[model samples]
Target: MSISPGPSNLYILARTMSDGHRSGVAAAGGMAIGSLIYVLLTALGLAAIFRYSPTAYTVLKLCGAAYLIFLGIQTIRASGAGNTSKPKVRIMGMSKVFKQSIVVELTNPKTALFFLAFLPQFVDPQLGQVALQLVILGLLYAILAFSSDLLVVLLSHNLGKWLSSHPLFIRWQDRVAGAILIGLGSYIAWQEFIQK
Candidate 1:
């Protein structure tokens, strides 16, 4: 479930494809690094804070939604002025992508909650150091997630290349991506506020 092509992952892949395979790979790397941090934080008991504090979770969720909105607005603005033949002049660097992805992952409280609820079922207290065991499992999960996301990046990059050839698609690609982000952000807000 963790490795699934969620909204944030798809957004990162699409954004990175603007810069080619290298960017896609970097985006995947960033995502993996972010997930790794979440896993470690969950192992270290950050999940407890999320679980117990609804307000904290809500705050994080809103921050994530806001960030998505920001990204969406940026994409929409770029689409109007973007060129299809070459990479966008505003193409993000690996470090910027890394930082953005990490923040996005961190603000997603559900990832931490998922880790909290899921990783412990396999634990055996008899083996000793529970924290160590959790850490190992979390690292293993991170590896699996990275493997899956890398595959996604490769596929998305190819698809992006195909899309780039079509003049209409090239013109609309960023706009579509931006709209998706905005919709996802709205969905998150609805899930957090209306559903509850």
Candidate 2:
């Protein structure tokens, strides 16, 4: 699950392509923190709120979807503004990127749900101190995830560097990224409203 292709991974790739490796790494750090937060919440039994409260789950999903859509629109608009003599590279603050990544991770209720469902399978009642076991497992998962995201950041940074030289790629990259974000948001919304 740590290495799977999902919104978090795609966001990391897009940020690396658009900004730089530092931005991607910052985003990865935020994601790790977000995962840790979820783990803590799970350990505290707060994550069960989502499982029990349909309204809370729906609200979170909608907020996530809206945020993604907003980001997509912003990206697309930025792409349109870049029709100039030279391809402009937008310099985003790493801290801002990190915060946004955290928001993205936190807004995705599925992540909390995943932890709620996944972490208990390995837990042993015989061992006692179930909360400590959960925290340890969560920490291990976060570390592995951070490692995987770092690998992605390195590879995508290289690819972005290579692609930056091509004017066509430079022109289309933001549009593509925006489209992906929009698609992801729409998919999530669809899953929430249609499937549910």
Clashes of each: 0, 0
Question: Which residue pairs in candidate 2 collide?
Answer: none
Question: What is candidate 2's lDDT per residue for 1-196, written digit by digit as tens?
Answer: 8787777788888788888899999989988988999889888886577668878878888898888887777778878755646647665689988998898787765565668777878889899998899899999999998999999999999999999888878878888888888888888888899966
Against the true structure, what is every candidate's RMSD?
Answer: 2.0, 1.7
The TM-scores of all predictions, comma-separated, are 0.89, 0.92
Q: Write the per-residue lDDT of candidate 1 for residues 23-118, one digit (tens) a residue.
A: 666766776777788777777787788778878778888888888878788778867665657655645777777777777676665565567677
Best model number under lDDT: 2
Candidate 1 clashes: the total is 0
